[model samples]
Target: MRGCSRRAGRAARKRRQKCESSIQSVSLGHQLQYVRLRKFLHQRGFTSSLLQPALFTDTGRGLQTLKTIKPCQLIISLPESCLLTTATVLSSYLGQYIKSWKCRLSPLLALCVFLVCERHRGEASDWFPYIDALPTTYTCPAYFADGVLAVLPAGVRRRASEQRRAVRELHSSSRDFFGSLQPVLSQPVEEVFTYEALRWAWCSVNTRSVFMSHPSNNFLSGQDHYALAPFLDLLNHRPDVQVKASFNDATRCYEIRSVSGTVRYQQAFINYGSHDNQRLLLEYGFVAPGNPHSVVYVDADLLCDVLRGDRSLDQKRKFLKENNFVHNLTVSSDGPSWRLMTALRLLSMPQTLYRQWKAVLLGQAVCEEREEWSVHTAVTLCQRLLQDTNAALEKISDLLRQCDPAVREQLDVVQSLRQEERCILGRCLEALRGTVRQPDEALPCQPDDNDDDDAVS
Candidate 1:
C-alpha cells in the first residue's frame, strides 16, 4: 500500500509539470504573433490573412475562429469593412490632411495649378484669353502661414502651410549647397591663410596667390642686366613651395606673355588647398593640338608619366631656343632688393610694405621718416613695370645726384631704355637710395658673421 501511494504521488507531480510546460509554450506563440501582427500593419494593403490566424492561434478561441468574429480578426476578413475602418481612424487622427487633399483635387485648385505651370507657354491660345484680364489674386489662406489650413477650415490651412514651408526649406538648403561658384570667387585671398584653406574659397584668389608665391624659381642673368621673368609668374605658385619661375628672353625686357598659355589661368586650380597640395600639369597637342587653353600643369607623377609623351619636349626645346633659359634667382631674407624684402616683410611683420607705400604717398608715416622713405623707394621698384620709364629713371638719377653727385656722374644709367648698363645703374641707384633712406634700418643685407655657414646655400 505504501509503494502504491508513492507511485501515484510521482504521477501527479509529472502531470502538473507537463501542464506548466504547455502553458509556457503557448506564451511563446503569443510573442511570435505580436511581431507578425506589427509587421503586417506596416505593409501596404495589410488587413486580413496575417492577423486572423495569429490572433486565433494565440487566444486559442475568438470570433476570428470562423464562428463569432464581430469584435476580432474576422472584421479583416471583409475587405470593404477593413478599409472603412482604416479611413475612419485616419480621419480622426488627421482630418486636416484629408480636407487639404480634397481641396487640391478640386476643379478650381487644378485650374490654378495648370495656369501657373502654363505661364511660359509660347502658344498664343495659352495666354490669349487672360492676356488683358486683371489677375485676381485669391485671399485663400496660403500654405505658407499656417500649420493647418485655416481657410474657414482652421486645421487645413496650417497643415498645407507646414508642407509648403518644409518643401521651401529643402529647396533653399539645396540652392545654398549646389549654387554657382560666384560667391566663392568673390572671397579675398587674405581671408585664407593657407593653400588648404583656399580649396573652398573660390578659384580666383587662391590661384592668384598660389601663382605669386610658388612661381618657377627662374631668373635671367646677362652680365650687368639681370631680371626675374614673368613666365614663372604665369605659374602663380603657392607660398609653401620653395620654387619660383625662371626664364630668359633675347629681348631686353623679360617677356612673361610668351609662356602665358590662354588656359594658364585654369591651371591655377592645381594648387588649391583641397587638392592635397598637388599641382596640375596639362599637356595636350593631338586633337586639340597645341591649343593654348589645353596647356596645364598637374601634381600627379603617375599622370605625368602617362601623359609624359603629351608634354611637348619639342615645344619646351622650342621655347628654350626662342627665349634664353635662365638660372634660379631665389631671393632670400638677405637679397639685393630692399623692396622685395619689405614686400615679404608681412610674413614676419604684420605691416605690409604696400600699405606703408599707400600711407607715405598720402603723406603719413607708420615708422621712422627714413623708413617711410624706404617704403616709397620700395614702391618705385614695383612701379617700374608700369610707370613712365624715362621719368622713373630721372627720378632715381635726381635722388642719386642729391646724395652723391660723383657716383651719379660715374654711372650714367638711364631707366628709360632696356639696356644692361641702365639696369646696373638703376640697381646701383636703388642701393644708394636704401642706404640714404635708412642708415639704421636693420635690412637683411649680407649674412652676419654669427649666422650659420649654410645661410645662403
Candidate 2:
C-alpha cells in the first residue's frame, strides 16, 4: 500500500497534466464553482471545518481537509434542498410527466432523468455549476475499451457487462418515456432528452450518488436509497478511512464526518461500503490503492475436474442453487469463505453419495467418510488454486512490459488485484500441502510434487 501522501502527490501530477489539456478551463471553473457552492451551502446553514475538493491520483477529485479534524467532527453538511432526491424528481416538470405515465420509474431511474433534464437545461438549469463540474469521462471498467476489458478478471468483466446492460435498459426506458411526451411537450426528443444524453446522466448518478434516508417522507420510505449530493459527491473512496454520513434532523443536512482523525492537507475519504476493486471500478470509476478487500473468483470450471461431464456439471450447479450454496468461489484478504469449502467438498464427492450427503449437509446425519472426503476436497482445491495462481503470475509479468500509459495504468490496477489473489492462493496451497501428502487416502488430483516456496507462482 502506498502512503496517502505519495498517492496524493502522484494524483496531483496526473490531474495537473490532465488540467493542462483542454479541461484546463473546467478545472479553473471548478475553483469558482467551489466558491459559489460553498456560498450556496452557507445560505442553507451548511458549514464545516474547511475541507475542499482536491486532486489525488487514486480518486482523481476528492475532499481534503485544510485544517485538523478530530473524529466525529463535522466534515460537510449538505441541506436537503441541495440534495437531488425522489421528492425533487416527483416535483419536477419532467418528473410529473413521467409519473403520469403510470409506469414505475424507480427513484434511481428518475434521478437519471432529472440529471439529463438539468444538464440539458444549461443556464436555465439551476444546478449548472454542479452539473458542469461532473467529469466528461469515467475510468470505471464499464467504460473500459473492449480490448482492455478482455484482460480483466472474470468477475470484473461480468460486472462491467451487467452494468452496460443495466444503463442501456435505463436509458431505453427513459428515452421511450421522453419520446412519448415530446408531441405534447414543446421540445424535440433529440433537443431535450436523447439516449446518449440520458446515458451520461445515468453514469453521473450511478458513479457519484450517496445514500439518503428520507424516513419521515410520505412519497418514499426511508430505505437508505441513493440521492445525488451536489458538492458532496466529489468525495472519493479510501479503504483505510472511516466516515459516518447521514441526515441529521437537528442540523437538517446530510452530514459527513471523519470517524478517524484527519490532519491538515490530508485527503479525507469515505467508505462506499465494504467494496472490492471489482466493485469500485465497476461503480465509482476508480480503485483505492492497496485495497485489502481485493478478491479474485475461481472459475467454476475448476469443479469440472472432479464433477466431470456436462450432465454432472449441470447437476452440481443445480444442487448448489437448490441448497442456496451458489456463490462464486473466491480468494480474498481473508481467504475463501466456507461456502467455497462446502462447494469444493460437494463437487469432489461421488454422485451416488449425494442422496446421503444431502441429509448429512442438512444436519440430518453424518457421513462415515466425512474426514476423508474433507482431505480429498482440500487436496483438489489446493492443486487447482496453484495452477490458477501460476497462470496469473505469468500474465502479471506480461502486463509489466506494456509501454502505453493506458495499458500501464490498467496493469497497475490489475496487478494489485492479481497479486493479492496470488498471495491468498499461496497461503491456501501451503496449508493444504500436508493434506495432499496424507497416506492411504485416494488423492482427488495429483499435484506437482515441487515444494519450492514459489511453486504456486
TM-score, cand. 1: 0.13
Q: Kindly give the stretch of ten consecutive residues in candidate 2 with the minimal lDDT sum.
A: 448-457
User: What Cα-based lDDT does every candidate model obtain?
Assistant: 0.25, 0.63
lDDT of 2 by residue, 220-264 (tens): 322537778877887767675688988888967888877877766
lDDT of each residue in 1-457, candidate 1, tens digit only: 0000011357865863454235311121245434443343334233332222211221121212223322112122111211111122223322333233412222212222223222223233222222112112211122112211221111222333553454344334323222222232234323322222211111211122211111221121111111111111122222221221222223212212212111110111011221110011100000111111111111122222322333233333233234332111112112223323332221111222323333333334333433443444343333332233344454555555554443342122222121222333344445445444455555432112222222110
**Relative to the unseen true structure, what is the C-alpha lDDT of residue 137 in candidate 1, on a scale of 0 to 100?**
21
Best by lDDT: 2
Give candidate 2 misplaced runs (Cα > 4 Å).
Answer: 1-30, 180-187, 215-224, 309-316, 359-416, 438-457
Residue 145 of model 2 has an lDDT of 54
C-alpha RMSD in Å of predicted model 2 compared with the true structure: 8.0
What residue runs in model 1 are displaced by over 4 Å at the alpha carbon? 1-363, 369-441, 444-457
